[model samples]
Target: MKKYNNLAEGPDGFVYTARLPLSSATLNWLSCLIRGHLKKIGSWWRALSAGRIAGIVLAVLRCDQRPSDLAGGNGVHRTTVSRWVREVVGLLAARAPRLDRALKKIARSGGGVVLLDGSLIRTPRRTGTETRKNYSGKHKCHGLLVIALTDDKGRLVWVSAVRPGRTSEITACRHYKLTAHLRAAGLGAIADLGFVGLDDGGPDADPAVIKCSAVPAQRKARRDYENRVSTLGAPA
Candidate 1:
């Protein structure tokens, strides 16, 4: 009987969602991942005694606020908050190699999906690059090339971000290389149009791999009609 297990109304007009058993399971998994990182860095003892650095970092990832706001929320200084973020980046870099093998094992077990997509993150105003603009369609805004992979139901699994808006989506895809990992692990992948044609005759492309298409069709009207029909029949 968890105290917060039942749904309630929030101060805002929206519903307060109940935390599912799966949410707890996922949090436990995330805790394990953080603990593993602390152990690898030989800071497990420090992490346990020095306060909830990993928890704050996770909160930053989950929340809509800035890092400073996250720090305040966790009752730590902004610099300490930034350090926690840095540690997360370091841990991810170290763990990325391990992920390949783990993904392969998961794929072998069968029936998973990897969704790849990108979104624009505006440049920090303090960064000098913010001044350099590109004018193609609208006023050229400096943006990040963000790629993320998720399960079919949209649970985030992996993420990568790069600066320089000119960085090709295909290059970003190849660099992250989740497709091969998913295939090896027994997972399917769904990617948008930017990732289409990547498998076409490049030295890096693998023609044999199977990936689910999240890519938009060239015939937009027909695709929209089909999409409406699919949405209507989708299980509630």
Candidate 2:
């Protein structure tokens, strides 16, 4: 995580290390974007370049290392790395408006079908009241649930805010009003059996917003089709 001082330049440009997991061009672009935003804040730290900060964040995420471990590797204080991570997250959140606009445009163009699914991110087991809320019966672990949306090609388009592990996938989607947003953008959505009741709307409902593919009546056929859809809809 320490600044990659001995960077080797390939024919394409400066080469990123395996741990960083980004092309040099992409790193540079992200650095510029992050730097521009930091400059607007009067108290932004000037000790590290935007590229270095971004590299640290990427390394931590790719390796799934704790902030303290990342700081030790990067030869920086733990608090410093933690602050950098928070800043990077805030910067990305600030760009949501632009990201949403682009997604809406893509949906309207009918570029691909939207697939909805839920996943759990593991968390440490808690005690007392918190334990029940974070325990996931299906996963047999304590975690937070996240509903994700991906295009037909399996590219992530949107992700709902994290909910407790006990929260049903459909319930989370309703809280986020995901169907309304998709319908407003004139996009269709497909989901697994877990979202079976999603299409059941009143007389005023628009059926196109949620498209449930027919599951074969035969047990073997239904299982095969479910497996196929699961493979296709798996998040990238």
Candidate 3:
């Protein structure tokens, strides 16, 4: 078989190179899942192969390529690519483990505190007051907020529901009652200062959620000390 990089088309235009930032095993797994989904939906066949449809979705997601660009390369309509992406995304989303279940699994495995993080998924800033709720003043951008937790090995175990961009990490956690969930699961978390006050009752009240309350100011002070040391050409 021709290598991925050497799949460019010639006069026949029957072959072309496409780059997907995922391994072959991942691609094959996704193709298998899509094929299974098609079987369940009573679709015996499609114009495009399951592998190709999987490739289109992976390109749009992992590679962050536009659907139109993928469509042109794959000889399909842009809407087809978009549809494939949505279908595959929904399929995979249905398989994601719930936060409580994921945390319980980690706890049973004798794992320690997990890492917590949050980020915004950027969206186009259209000129409309209706979209004001999506504007995040902290990041000075428009997007959706999402929170995630990873195991000790840095594998994602849980993800929070999508919230407005204006939402803070701590606020989202509280909204979801993440503290009660973590305490119930017997798991702890180490998060950045963004979640400083996540545990309203304080760390002692719920030691499951550890924060830097003892030396909160030390984070900034350490950074300032490092900058001064570098400027003075001395080690402090």
Off by over 4 Å in 2: 1-18, 97-103, 208-236
lDDT of 2 at 181: 71
lDDT (C-alpha, whole model) for all candidates: 0.54, 0.70, 0.79
lDDT by residue (tens digit), candidate 3, 56-144: 78888997888987787778889988888999999999998988999888877877567788889999886778578889999999999
lDDT winner between 1 and 3, please give it.
3
Report the Cα lDDT for residue 87, model 1: 73
lDDT of 1 by residue, 98-142 (tens): 546555544554435445677556664344654443111222555
TM-score of each: 0.53, 0.74, 0.81
Off-target runs (Cα >4 Å) in candidate 3 are: 1-16, 202-204, 213-236
Candidate 1 accuracy as TM-score: 0.53
Give Cα distance to truth, residue 121, candidate 1, Å. Answer: 3.6
Candidates in descending lDDT order: 3, 2, 1
Query: TM-score order of candidates, best first?
Result: 3, 2, 1
